[model samples]
Structure formats: structure tokens, C-alpha cells
Target: MGNRTAVIVACALVGLTVSTPAFADSPAPSTYGRASYLLDESTGKAMISKRADKRVPIASLTKIMTAYVVLGQAKLTDKVRITAKDVRYAERGGATTADLRPGDRLTVKELLYGLMLPSGADAAHALARTYGPGVDGFTAKMNATAKAMGLSNTSYVNADGLPARGGDGYSTARDQARLAAAALRNPTFRSVTSTKSRTVASTADHRAYSWTNTNRMLDAPGSLGVKTGYTRAAGFNLAFAADRKGRRLVGVILGETDSSRRFDTARSLLKWAAKHPVEGNG
Candidate 1:
């Protein structure tokens, strides 16, 4: 493992603790996200909080729960036949997609790449229908999974995060940071989210598909895995994590108004954490 990886592992050996945003010197610059949070894994302190608890539409970030529920209930090797219904759902929603076509037989693992890296609404449908009694059952599991994880503010009406006419899933930065922390605890979820790109061959027929991760923060230094989101209702959102100097940090930014700004804010969050270095407890 690289030196940085070693530091992260070591930092994790001690329990997580969060210090107040008391900086060693000057406070970090004002941030931009409607809800922004920073968790300093070394001290376990919430080093930054800007409306971290205000509930708002969460967009595709709901997929983290979708992934968690599926991973808990399905085997990665299980073969799931893609269906016309799934593709059709994707067509109507205007969601980001990995070009999943009907009749492509993909494994659960392959579908996860579709579900996460490209944020495929079709892949979400496939996993939900295959694992749950139906899409409704699967979405119930998503909410149940959220509650079980202590995500009180989170709700899910769809496996993908397309808002229902009356309901778009809403979660606070605190709840999402909690969700991301839980997802990272699952090795498979962590590995998949951190991967920048993947090419998986359909086990049933051998057709291949490739996907790239949606979180641009993954390209930044010390960046790790997590997830991203966007919608007319949710604006641009991102849940991001990183490892630098053996410490792990989790950041969440919701409702950033646009795509590029979400990334710019996320990078700024990390830089702010690095420079501020929370110090002096009350």
C-alpha cells in the first residue's frame, strides 16, 4: 500500500472523533453549497458546517442507499436480465445513463457499476426489481435500510432518485455524511465508489460496457470514493470522501445550483479543512 493509504488505515484504528470548527489560526473562507459539511476523521470533529442539517431534495445521492440495500441482499455474481421496462423508465426520467440496453444480461456487480459510476436509472430499476419483491418492495428496503442506519431525515420513493410528482427524497448534509460513512464501511460499496472507471462483461452473453464515475472530486488529490447528485428539484449535490496524510475525511455539499460549482465547492471544502486544522476544544 502507498504511504497515504497506510495513514488512513492507521487513523481508522482509533475511533472517530470530531472537534468543533475551531481553527488553529484563521477560519476557512466562506463556502458556497446550501448545505456543506466536513468531518475530520483524525479528531472526528465536524470541522465545517454550513446548514448541514436543512432538509432538501437529494437527487441521485439516494443511490447510495439503493446500493447499500442491494449489496446487503444480493450476491454480486447473480445474473440479472435487463428488461424493456427498465430502459423505458430511464428514457422518461432524463437521468444520466450508461447506455444499458434491454436484453443485456449483466451481473449484480456489473449493474452496480451502471447504477453508480454512470448513475444509470435503468441499473437502479434492474437491481430493485431483481432483489426486492418488486420495485416498491425494493424501495421500501431502501427506506428501511436508511432507518436501520439511523438516517432519520432520509426518505426514498424510487431506486433511482427521480422525484415523484409530490415527493423528491430529502436528506440533510449530516444524514448524508452518515449515509456515506455507512456505505464506506461496506468493502464492496467502498471499492466500487472509489473506482474511477470500470469495464464489465455481461456474464450471460459477454457483451461489454464501460462507465466512469460521476464525482469529479475523484480526480482531485487525496480524493476517494463516495457519490454525486443532480436534479431540477435537488440542484447539484455531492457526497465526497478523501484520505490525506493517513487521515480520512468525509464531506457533503447539497444544492449547489449547478454541476461545476458543486465540484468547485467540494474541492474548496477539502482545502479549507487542510488549512484550518481544527484546534482548541471548548
Candidate 2:
């Protein structure tokens, strides 16, 4: 086996303790869909891979990309009006909402909190309507940014990631991982996702509303920030990252059974990755 793989196996056996154990020749869980990958931030190497290049529906995890697009185009202090067009009629009933009303005024920063913390589809639409010229216009910008970032397999349709009539919103595990890494580069993006609770002050028509992050893993001590997504078609999708002893790891698991299981898998994967310290800055 390769040295890094051998190290990971040894660490897995001994529990990442000081005394490494003999490498085990066992298979890891193969429970995932279209694509999944674990990235070693220190060496910029993908330690595990499965269909990393295949584009698939990513659900609300697409909001992270939405945040990236909006943060670049608008300032936090800017005020946005939540229009009717921004809210999606939830025929299937998706939770994690800002519950924005028409003409309610809020700062771009708070809207970001709404988007990242609650996975607010309304907030996503608000940003797109304001800065994207329209949804299609904003999607164009998203694709352009993806190309710039060398994400050849990524594409976005609706800003809220509800999935279009045909196959529209799509991304690969590798693409999502790269996007998460890039999003972390922006201090604003990192700030919003890492925070557990956000309280937006009352607007003229509404009282203060507190939104909690959807990613349960953030409740853990070392987790920095990440996004989660789900749909009947997409199953359970999650993008997760954490820091321990100054080392960071990002992982994605697509198509799981339940919400808690997805989060648990994320925590487990992150813990495992944390155990194997990569070369250099790890």
C-alpha cells in the first residue's frame, strides 16, 4: 500500500494515538451514492475517492455556492427587500427557513446568516434577485466563477437548489469539496457557516428571529463550518469540515438514509481524517 494509505490504516487501527498500530486489511464502508471523496488539505491529495467526477444533484448544499456568489457581488451592510418572488412554495415542505416577508429589510450580512445557518431558500432567492439580474443571470455568474475556480464538473440552476424541471443543478464530490475549500478562503463565508445560532434584529414588520445552523456537526467543539442538503432524488448530502490541533479536513457523503446518520457519518469521517496527520502543515 501507498505510504499515506498505510498511515491511514495504521492510524485507524490504533485510533490516531501516539502509538500507531499495525495496518489492517479491511474494507471501509461503501455506503454512498454517485460520488464521494475525502480531501487532505495539507497535501491537497484526495485520500479516498468514488465517482468524484460524476455530476449529481446536490440539494441545499448548493447554497454554499450561492453564498460565495453573493458575498463577492454585494457588501454585508447593503439592505435587501425580501420580495414574494424569493420565497418558494414548499409543496414538499422543506424546513430551515428565515420566514422572510415582502418588503422586510435586512442587512446582507444577516441574509448570509439566513442562507448559511438555516439553509434559507428565501435568502438565496433574495440575493439572486438583487445581484443576479435574475436566477438565470445569477446562475451564469455561478458557472463563470466555477470555471475560474477550475471546477469543470459543477453547474447550478436554482439559487435555492430545489432542482429544475429537467436536470439543472448538479455538482461532483470533487467539485463540492473544492468549492467548500474556496468558500472557506472567504472570511465572511467561514464566519456564517461556523456560527451555531444567529439572531437577526426585528424589521419593521417582524420581530427578531433566531436561526440555528442545520449542520449538527458544528455543535461539536472542533468543527469549523459546512453545509447540508437533501431531496427525494438526491437523498442525504452533506459537506463537512473540522479543525483539531490546527489541522483541517473536509469530507462529503452523498445519499444516506437519515439526517442524523449523515451527520454521524460526517463526524466519523472527519474524526478518522483528523487521526491521519498529513505531511507538512497537518
Candidate 3:
């Protein structure tokens, strides 16, 4: 096995034996997803992992990377005019939308709220077009960023995580945990994902809009905004982060057949990890 794969296996094995006094009587969290991973964000230790390296379609979780790339290149105040094509792309795909209107102009910051909160394919297209100059160019940046971040098992074919004609975008639980760690470090990215709701007042340039986050975990204590995604092919997917007593954890659940179960599993894992705090490298 490759050195990296070997290390992951070792960590997964270690995670299996970890337990603490706080949850001595509690059973370990049971995950219903096909793949799941949890990490101690401070030390990069694997806390709980199951088939973490298995690659699968990621659905709207693709938007996390989309936001990451856009934050790297665009100023929050920069304006992008919504195009009919952008609106049409989301509608034709029967994808979620931010309800952005064509001919209306909104800032990059506003669009991000639309993108992350509603898992808006329309908002993703607008940002991709503005920053990438086109969908192809933007997705190229997404793939390049993934490689640079050392996410070997992840690939992106589109900005919004929608399935491409050839194939859908794919990623493993472990790679996604790492990606969430990197993304949560960015203040703008963190703020956008954590927001439960955002309202943009109407102006002459654009219509008013309000977006509610799709991530249900946001309401939970210590929950930090990350991202959530779903598609017929991808199943219910979630990349999540939480903080407890200054210790932070990041996790990903992919290929969950049940929507509510994904969040339940995440909460269970987070609560379990809080009790079994990582010491040193865990």
C-alpha cells in the first residue's frame, strides 16, 4: 500500500480503540452513511472514521470548493450581473436555486450567501462565470486547487456539484474533512456557511432576496457552518464542523440514504468526540 493509505489505515485502527470516561457508558456513534470521517481539527487526528477513503459522488458539497475558489479570487464588493443563462442552467437541471433574477446585479458576498445557504446552483454559476470567465475555466481552477491541497481522491467536473454528462464529481470523507478544515480557516467562508439566514434588501440594481441555510446542524450548540449536499446519484451528503470547549472537530458523511439521518449521525459523532477528546496526535 502507498504510504498515505497505510497511514490512514493505521489512524482508523487507532480511532476504533479510543474511548473516555465521559462516555464510558455510552455506545459509540453509529453512522448510517456509506462513508464517514471525523477529525480533531486542532491536531489533524482521526477521531472516528469508516470507509473514509472511499470515493463517491458529492452532490452540492461541491459548492464548498466553489466558495473556496471564489473567495481566493473575488472581492466581496465586486458585482456580478445575473444572466439568463445562469438562471436557466439551474432550472433546466431541476437543481436548488437562490432565486436570483436575470439583469439584477449583486455583489460577490451576496452571491456567496445564495450559494452556500440554499445550495444555489444559480449562484454558483454566477460566481463561476464571473471569476472563471466561464464554467470550464472555473471548474479547472477547482480541480487545480484540489490537487494543490493534496486531495488525491477528489475530483470536480462542475462548480455546483451537479452531475456532469460524463460523470458526477466525487470525493472521500477524509479528503472532505481536510477540505473543510482548510475552508473553515477563512473568515469569509466561515461566516457565510455559519449564517442561518441572510436577507439582501432590494435596490434599483437587484431584487431583494433572503436565503436560509440548508444545513440543519447550524441550530445545534457549537455548530459551525460548513455545507450540505444531495442528488439522486450522490445521496444525502454533509461536510460539517463544530467547536466544544475550544476543541474543534470537522467531519463528513457521504452517501447517506436518509436526509435526517445524516445530521443525526454527525451530531452523534460530534458529541462522542467531545467526550473522548484527542490528546496530542490522538
Candidate 4:
């Protein structure tokens, strides 16, 4: 009887050993953002989620949708002439700009670089005005697209995500993760977001311009281009994606108080996700 009891105990110990997770000894990653979400891109499985449903301002990450909408309607080669109105719109908001000049005829592709790389409000205004035929019209399309995409926690008030009277645009980390995953599927978006910097040479119609990506995680291994944003109200934000041995992960961090720490938190989360096994959506 004693031998039988010992044998049963031994078997239980073996089972426990076999079931132990490889990452059991590692601490879970810490995040500085008020909210965050991470997902396995291939399976749409959630790996990490925090305050994922709490809506908050998203700042210039709004440009991700802006680019998505424009990519759907306009060809990359389509030309858009920058107007004084576009420049003024950005400047008046005290928002970031690409320093784009009025009367400069730039291709949709160039404007995208300006829009994304620097998080340029002017570029967003230009694209919205031309594509929507008016800012209000373009904003409507943004809301429609968000609804169609099933991003229930998201809403847009303007093209560049500047503060509006009623509210600045808002979204949850979970919704932003889903949006980032969808946007990364487009090759043009992947290319544009992954780029670290872009320089368009001076042409007869436009002046030479250069812009740099705001996403610092681009330098990390397997990092993919997504977007970054900040405002006094929004804090630091990032929608990030990365691939490790063909396994891709997409994530969003919102309301991080420190700009550089947002990237650090993202990298730590990615590393944690890679080490652990995928689980059900959060």
C-alpha cells in the first residue's frame, strides 16, 4: 500500500514537470502605458491586454486610418497639389508638419510618406481635403470605415487627430491592435510604415523634402512599421508590429507618459510574447 501511494505521488510530480511552461521562471513584461494589447497576427490571438476597452484619445495615430482610406480610394501616383489651406490647418493646430509648401504638386505616395513618417498634420489635411473633397466629408468616411471594420470602441473627429470641440478622437488598445493588423496586411502600408526616412527630391512642382519615422521600435529586430503619436491629452502612443521567425505580433500602447519608455515597453512585450505560447484572445 505504501509503495502504491509513493508511485502515485511520483506520477503526479512527473505530470507537473511536463506541464510547466517554459516561461514559468520569467517575469511577465511590465508596461508603462495606461492601456495596451498584443496579438498574434497570424491567428488573431490575444497575448496581452490591459484596459483594452477603455476609450481614450489616440492623437496622430489617426493617420493610420487616414492612410488606409486614401490607399483604398487613390492611386499612389495620383498627384495632389498642396495649398495654403492645408499648411494653415496644420500650423493653426500647433500640430506637427512636414513643412510642405503651397502649390507643390506631390504624388499620393509622397504625401503618404509625409503623413506617416513625420506624423504630419498638413499631409493629412491635404489627403483628407482632396480625397474627401472636404475635411468634413473625409471625416465621415473615417467613421464609416471604423464601423465597417467592427472597431466598436473607435471614433474619429478629424483627419489628423487634433483636439476637437466635443472630443479628440478616441479608441481602445484592442481596437487599435485590430486596426494595425488590418493595415499591415496591405503591402503599400507595410512598405511605408517600415521605412525609417524618406526624401523626395526637388522637382519643378515641389521642393525637396525629407521626413523620418516617429516609431523608434523600427530599429529593433523583426520590427515592422506601424505608427506613433502624442498630444498633451493623449500622452505617448504606439501601434507596433514585429516578426520573429515568421511569427508576427501586433500591439498597441496608449497613454504612456514617457515617450521613449513606450518603445521599451513594446519591445519587452514582444519579447515576452515570443517566449510564451499563444493563448485565447483577451
Best by TM-score: 3
Q: Write the per-residue lDDT of candidate 3 for residues 115-182, one digit (tens) a residue.
A: 99999999999999988989999999999999999999999999998888998889998899999999
lDDT of 4 by residue, 192-256 (tens): 99999999964545458989998899988888869999999999999999988678899899999
lDDT of 1 by residue, 1-282 (tens): 755455444433432222352342443445565777777766666876677778898999989889988888889888899889898888888888877888888888888889999999999988898888789999888888888888888888888889888777788988888778777878898888989999987543656787999888887787876888888878888999887766677888888877888788778768767765554322
Candidate 1: where is the Cα deviation over 4 Å? 1-21, 203-207, 275-282
Error of 4 at 261 (Å): 0.6
Ten residues in a row with the worst lDDT in model 4?
13-22
Output the worst ten-in-a-row residue range by lDDT, candidate 2.
Answer: 14-23
Q: In model 1, where is the ten-residue run with the lowest total lDDT? A: 10-19
Which parts of model 3 have CA positions greater than 4 angstroms off?
1-27, 203-207
**What lDDT is obtained when candidate 3 is compared to the true structure?**
0.86
Predictions ranked by TM-score, top down? 3, 4, 1, 2
Query: In candidate 2, how many Å is residue 96 off?
Result: 4.7
TM-score of each: 0.87, 0.86, 0.90, 0.89
RMSD of each: 8.2, 4.9, 5.3, 7.0
**Candidate 3 residue-pair clash tally:** 0
The per-residue C-alpha lDDT of model 2 at residue 259 equals 68
Clashing pairs in 2: none
Residue 144 Cα positional deviation in candidate 1, in Å, after optimal superposition: 1.2
